[model samples]
Structure formats: C-alpha cells, structure tokens
Target chain A: MSAALFSPAAPGASPSASPGSPELRAQFPILARKVHKQPLIYLDNAATTQKPQCVIDALTHCYTHWNANVHRGVHLLSQEATEHYEGARKVVAQFIGAALPEEIVFVRGATEGINLVAQTLGRTQLSKGDEVLITGLEHHSNIVPWQMLCAERGATLRVCPITDAGELVPGAFDALLASRTKIAAFSWVSNALGTVNPVAAMCRAAKRAGAITLVDACQAVPHFAVNVQELDCDFLVFSGHKLYAPNGSGVLWGRKALLESMPPWQGGGDMIASVTFEGSTWNHVPHKFEAGTPDYPAVAGMATALQWLQAIGLQRVQAHEAALLAEATERISAIKGVRIIGTAAAKASVLSFVIDGVHPHDIGTILDRKGIAIRAGHHCAQPVMDRLGLAATARASFGVSNTSADIDALVEGIVAVQKLFGA
Target chain B: MSDLGDLYHDMILGHAKAPRNFGKLDPCDASALGHNPLCGDRIGVTLLLSQGRVTDVRFDGSGCAICTASASLMTEGVKGRTRAEIDTVFQRVHDLVTGKGDPEDPELGKLAVFGGVSEFPMRVKCATLPWHTLNAAFDNSNAPVSTE
Candidate 1:
C-alpha cells in the first residue's frame, strides 16, 4: 500500500507522479507535520486540500512583491498585479479549454457561481411552471438556488432520481428532459457519494432538448482534465480553494453568446464601463459579472495552482487517482461493518461510507484524535443522504499528495471504532 | 487511536442497547421530537409533568451507538426532576460533550466519558440532540420544537 500511494508511472519530479519517491511530498510542507503526535493522514480532499509550495509561494509574492488593485492601477506594482491577475484568467481559461479568456468570469467559488447562474438565467428566460431537471445527488449549493428560483417564479424543480446502486440511470436524465425544462444544472461529480457524472454526454442530450446545461465542476476539475468545449456545456463552474488555490476565488466559464445574454448579478464598482450619474453601462462578458474589488492575489495564486496541476498533467493525475480509488474501494469494502456508498462504475477520488453502528460524527471525532482527517457528515448533500436513507456518512477523498498509506490509516481507524463499538 | 471513552463507555452501550423508557408515552402532558438531520438521529421526547416538575420522561428514536446511548442515558438522569434542576443537567452535558467544563455533579458520572468528544466538532450536535429535545419539551410555549 505504501509503495503504491499515487505512483502510476512517475510524471517527472511531481510527488505521486514518481513511484517510490517521496520528494513530491516535500512540495507540500503540511504533510510532514503531525496532528496529535501522529502523522497527518489527510484524506478529506472533498471538503478542501492542502496547498502546494508553488501555490503558497504565489500567494506570498502577491502580498510581498507585486501588491496592487486590479484593473484600475497605474503604477508598476499595480501593472504587475493586473498582469498576473489576467494571467490567471488565461490560465483558468486554458485549464477548462475555454475558447477565449473573456468567457471566464472569476467569482468567489462554486456556490456563488451557481447563484449567479440561477439568478441571471432563471430571471432572463424561465417563467412560472417551467421545470429545472436536477438529480438527487446534487449538493445544497446546486439544489437551493433552483429551489429559491422555482419558488419565486412559480417554476417547479424536477428531480432525477438515482438507482439503489447509486449510479444515475442512463436514460433517467433524458426522461426528465421535458420541453418545459429550461436549465439543467447538475454536479459533474457527486460530492457526497463520489459519483462521477458524464456531463459531456448529458449536456449533449440537454442541448438536443433545447434546454441549457450547466455543471458544478468543483470536484471534477481537481482530478481530471476538464474541457468545457468537449463537454459542450453552456456554463461550467468550479472553485479555487478546492483546486489547491487560496480561498475566495473561483471561475464560471460560459459560451461567449450565453454570457453576453445574461444580466449582471451584483451592482457596485468594477462592473460598469461608464457612469454619468444618469445611466450606467456594463462592461464586457467577464467583467460585467465580476463586481467590486475582486480577490486579485487569490486569482494570481489560482494561476500558479493551475500551473502546478498542469505540470503533473491532468490525464496522468486522473488515471492515478482512479487507480487509487479502485484499490481503496476493494480493500475498504471488504472490511466487516463497512458499507461503501455510491457504487457507481464511474467515480472520482471521494469515498463515502457508513459503519453499521458507529455514528459518522463519532467516527470523524475518533479519526481526528488519531491525526487522520476525514470528512464526516452529510457532506452538504442532504438530499443524497435522504435518498440513501441515511443522515450522514464518513467521507475520505484522495488528492495528488494522498498515499496508499493514508488509506491504511483510515482502515485502522475504522477497525478501532469497530472494536470500541463491539461491531 | 480511538478509546472506548471516545466511542462509548460500558454503561452508555448498555443503555443504548436497551433504553429504560423505550416506548411511547400515551396521553403525555408534553411531547417533543428532536432530530439531528445531519446524522439521521431522531428522538421522540415525551414528558409527564406533575405541577411543573418532570414526573416522567421517555424518549425513543433511531441513531448511531453514541447518540442512542446518549439518549438512553439522558432519560434516566432527568426523570422525576424539576425543570430548574434539569436545566443545569442540560447545561452540564452540553458543556461536557461540547468541551467546556464539568463541575463533578453526580448526575454526570458516566457521562464524563463523553468529555473527550469536544475535540471532534461535528459530533457535538449528535450527543446533544436528546438533551436539546428535553429542554424544548419542558418549555410549554409550543409543540415539539426542532433543535437543529
């Protein structure tokens, strides 16, 4: 297990890229430290992840060297900050395979990105009784915005249910694609159950129905090569903090025409082109949505984070993470009293499970004391929890830095809980 | 690294396996249902009050071992006690499980093992669901309140 942590044909010096080399681990300064005197077996990648030294260095440079407000500065420092910030936009655009940089709008994260789409798109076209086709596996961020929109405009929210096996029934999504369905918002990967949804195929189906498609790619982007054009999705969103960048930064990429048609979400500074105290004109596609003074430094950090991810190569990362997932599911599922959820054929690095008698919260607390960090709760997907007939689940997600030994720590922790609970 | 104290003590496991008042109380003077939806821990709290004093207390629900045990233990500590005395117990349990301070109150003997739970922030709600329901049941202003 230790030898096979994340090494699947080393992608050069990147940790996990090289088999049997721990040098990549040093890039992340936090992995060396221990919690409760035990080495930190960090597995809660679904919630967030530890930043690499490159990302941390970018953050430091933004504050220590080229610190300035973006889009409005005239001095050298401001010019440098503006260049780096826009450079981040280009990096993010390339990362998602967007056709143009202006199509990418930097928002806070996935939550705000969803809210922006719901508010703008729903208000623009959706009328009362129109339907929004979503799945039972959607996170609260995806569900709540549509709910609020539906309630306001008398539009109804339609749910695409999942099978007992936790896979999205192939044509089940197609069945929900009614003529009344205006927008189809779904997570590219189910955060709760680690179900990797086929967004490209699903979006193609939605396009055939004339219903617009949007994806919450927060979970998918970190592990896979996300090509918005390949997906053919009308709109795609993801967060920076979850992508190894600093907090308060994310990207919402849409087709140029689709973004141009949408209205501005918030009003204030930086979104307007001209103000005469009589009538104000909005900026271009991306700038029109990015309101107020944005998190410039964080955006710079995100660019650097994307660089690090690209350095490892997304395809290699995805394959390695998938291999790790396969090994983990095989071993962890065989344990008595351990029932893994989301047994879908397609899955990301996330693994959610429940022990027979131990509460998820209890499992989390016990794991934390042992310095093995895992996310335990509903994972902000209460609807999925309800669908599975559970209140919460213990989730262990993998990242580039995660090793097979981390899974061992998790199994050991579960065994300890079983011994204590007499399960 | 999980201690028996962190998961369950012998008494808590015993009570959770078989709670004392594990049935519904008919014609109950006060009743409340508390659920930590996060954990699917649901408890029906029924109170039989005699002139503002808690003459009888019973709770039945489904949850994990720790929560079920905590709920079972809660019913025993508050039976035949006054509202004023029960409030103190609630506060003590909240503090103990939530990691504040325990003042050696005899009612909190076996419950003291839960003092180790505070380090884990997510489980605090699970351990306190029953106690919160008990407090709401004592308050007669409304029907069963949601102690989220």
Candidate 2:
C-alpha cells in the first residue's frame, strides 16, 4: 500500500500475470476461494498447487467424452485415447526441453519417478564399493529410495554437505564426486529450503566424472525456467501437482540411450511387447517404464498444465514468483525470532523459515486457523532437518496465482505465531 | 488477516506454548517413540505404571498445537487412572482421530474438541500422533484396544 513496498513483479502483474496466467487461474476454480471468512491466501504451492481450469477441464473432458482405457482396445475411442496420452508426452517434453518424447516417462509423480530411477538405474550399475552421491538437502522421497537401493545392493549412499546459508557447497559436491560415485541426485530447487542448485555446472561436473546425475526438479519446474537440455543432466524428474497439474502424474526425463538400456521397473500390461506364461518381452523405452494402467485423466490434466505454463511463458512466472518470494522473505524474516532457513545466493520462488522456540507445527496450526495455507515440518527433507539441527521448519512457497496481499496475510499470521510463542 | 479465534481458543495455544510435563523421562521404562515423518511430529510417552494403575504418566513431544496439546491432555487424563481406564481413553481418542471410532465418547472430556480435526484430513495425524504413540508405547500392556 505504501511506496516502501517493493513489488518484484512489474506493474499490473500477478502470479498468473503471464499471457494465459489469468485464464490459467480461471481454470483452477479453487483459486477463487475464501478461507475462515477471509480471502484464501494459498502460499502452499510447494506442498501442492491449485489446478487451473484447463487442467480441470481436461480431466473432466476425458471422463465426460473419451474415458476408454488406453493401450488396450483398437476402437475409435482407443485411438483417440492413445493419441491424447502420447500427445501429453510431447507436451511435457517441450515443457522441460527434453530431447525426445521417449525420454519423458510418465510416472505417479516426482516421488515415484525418483524411485523408478533408483530402482532401475541404481540396481543395474551401483555395486558394493559404488557410492551414491546425494546432498543432505533431499526429501525423504529422494533419500529413502537410494538408501533402500544401496541396502539392496552392496552400494553406499554418500552425502554432500550444505552450507550454513542452505546452499549446496559446489566444492563439497565436487569433492564428493569421486571415482566410486555412480550417481549424483539432488533437487534442482530444494523443496524445504527453496535453494536452487547450480544445475548446469553441477550436472556438467557430474558428467565429467562419468556419474549419472538425477535432478529432482519437483520444486524447480513450478517456479523457474527449467530446460533439461540446458542442464544436460543424465536424468530429471518433476511432479505434476507442483506444476498446477493433477496428482498421480509426473515426468521422468532421461538421456535417450541410458533410459533405453534399462529394463522395465514395473511390469503389468502396456509395458509388455508380448505376454507369455513363461516370460514376457518388454516394450520400448517409455512404455517399458510405464507399466499397467496409467493415470490417463491426470496425464491429460498435466499436459494441459504444461501447456498453460508454456502459454504464460516460464520467464514471466519466474519473475512473478520471485517478487513474491523476495517480498515475503524480507517481510517475514524481519519478524522477531523468525529465522529464514535457506539463504542461497541464487534461489527460486520459495521462502522457508523457522520461528525460534516455536515448533513449526504450532506455527502451521496458527496460520491455518487464519486460512493462510503454509507447509510446516521437515517437508520430507529429513536430511536437511538433521543438518540444520531442527525437527522441522515452516515453508511458504509461491505460485503464479499468489499476490502481495497473500504475503501480507502470511506475515501477519507468522507474527501471531511469534507473539504467541513469545519468540 | 482476521483472527479465526474459535479455531485457536486460548486453551489450545496455551497448552502448545507452555505444555505441562514437557520433555523426555530419563529412566523411561515403558517408552516408545512414534514419529510422523511427514509432519515431523515425534512423541515419546513414558508410562510409570505400578500394578494396574498408570500412577504417574509423562510425555515429551515436539509437534503441532493439536499433537502437543493432545499429549499434554493425555498425561492429565490418564494419570492416576488404571491400565483398563487408560485403554478406554485411548480407544475413545483413536476413534475420534482415525474416523473409525466415535468422536462423542462421553468420558473423553475436553479432548473431545479435537473431533473437528477429522475435518482436515492432514491434521488427523496431528491429532492422533500422541494417541498412537501412547498405544505403541503401551505395546506390552496388550490392554484390549482398537486403533482401527
């Protein structure tokens, strides 16, 4: 309201201020909401995002018209279904700058996508002496899978430490990338801390060391202009829900030859070339990873979600979200006893912090009562919590639909928590 | 931001801010740690039992308002009550949380306020984490209960 307020978004710009930002928010009817008799301030995009009208429409469109099971029948509906399903692949490929459609294997989301690679790629190559390089700033979804993979094989899971400011120390990451390092998997943008890793350089370093790099773009894809080609990582994964797409749908993009060589991770119907009682010949690359009845409705919604982002342009979304993050960071961090967690020099649109002496859960409950949705806890990044010597931290992540008004509400809500805790 | 005051009645925030009998018991004989890694709620319930009565009960946990309050309330409710009485209270609270049990168990006392938690599916765990931790900690008790 004052001249002192610094709006990162240019004049007349909102989160959905991109070309189709308004239309996209319109698609996600939930954005039009009120909470606890107040206007909804959804700062929990990092947790899960509100779906736009197009994503909702696409989902409804599939069930309303062509709801046939894909990759089974050769009927008119089946052909239509297959075309739309495969079309989504191209949409996602273009969305992330993947080299080919085959590289983008549709999984249940980033969690499952990470598990798929850890199970398949990890199983095939990782041996006892082999070290799986990862950072302490990973979600349990990223850490647990490799732990299981390493436990299954004789492999070891090595961690790259984070700096006090929450950025991954580049030199430490490089130091961890030794000869035994089979793979280096880290979040392109950390979910808990919102620290965006130096992907292009990090991936380049990993590649030179002959290690497969898996980038969890779950948080990044929603807030930044991410290009798989630009990063040139061996594999990249992101979730649909974070990108304003439906849940149970995600993309796992790998280099062509590397993904092609791996066997099917899960086996059922569509992933098979020929099914015999004794043995089954596997299908091609994408299908090989995509086993059983995929979430067609969700995939349809996800494709539209990506298309929605494309229409708005990633750069505009980035700018809008960045402004929100900066405004929120400066305002919320100024609150007494509230320490901002991740202070990476270069970051995306997430503002994570913890109110001193106040458990994040208490802060979360207080905020939710005010109808301001924010994520509080380890954020599935237990390793990060362990490093920070914290049980949990509260995170307020941004999206295109968010506004300065929401940040104001969040600041007020956090102040309430701080005062209540006497922090 | 208007205060949704009813949701954060002073009692709830009061309990969360300055919990009664907070922190772990050193010689925790019957202690079990139930962790909700999703929300990072961890509760360590130490039951100081003698014969059948719970005698003096204590809990140490770090979690949201509801979970900590629930843990605090449990220590108050179960103290001086027999093992069978504790079992009944646990069932009442479990049902109140997981939606399988009745929220309106008359003996549940002020703890019944958490019944509204089922409205928010995610917070169900927040409401139930302490109760679940209590059950798990009393695993050897086998005192006829249902968390279903």
Off by over 4 Å in 1: A1-21, B1-7, B37-40, B98-103, B107-110, B118-122, B141-148
Instruction: Give chain B TM-scores in order.
Output: 0.87, 0.80
The total number of steric clashes, by the backbone 3 Å criterion, in model 2 comes to 9
Tens-digit lDDT track of model 1 for B1-148: 4443755667767776677777678878887788776656788888899978877778887776667877777777777788898888778888887668763657786677667557656667777888888877777534655546
Q: Write the per-residue lDDT of candidate 2 for residues B1-148, one digit (tens) a residue.
A: 3233443456666787778877766666577777777777777788777776766667785777777887888788887877678788878877776666665677878777666665556677777777777777677542322223
lDDT of 1 by residue, A1-423 (tens): 111111222224452344213766777789889888889888988899788777776767677877788888688877777777787788889889999999999999999999999999888889987999898889999999999999988999999889876778778899999899999999999998889887888998999999999899999999999898889999999999997888988989989998999999998788998988798999888999998999987887788778777877788778778888898898889999899988998899999998987778778777887899998878989888878888889999988877788778888899887877687
- Model 2 clash pairs are A15-A400, A16-A400, A27-A52, A27-A53, A28-A51, A28-A52, A28-A53, A128-A154, B95-B101
- How close is each model in CA RMSD to the real structure? 4.6, 6.4
Tens digits of per-residue lDDT for model 2, A1-423: 111111112223332445324543554567678876666778888889987666666777788777788888988887777877888898888888888998889998888989999989899998888999998788878899999999999889998899888988769998889899999998888888888888888899998998999999998888777888888898999889988888998888999899888878988888989998999998998999888889988997788777667667788888888887888888987877889988988778778888877778768777887888888878877878878888888888888888787787898888887776556
What residue runs in model 2 are displaced by over 4 Å at the alpha carbon? A1-27, A419-423, B1-15, B23-29, B76-79, B88-148
> Where is the poorest 10-residue window by lDDT in model 2 chain A?
A1-10
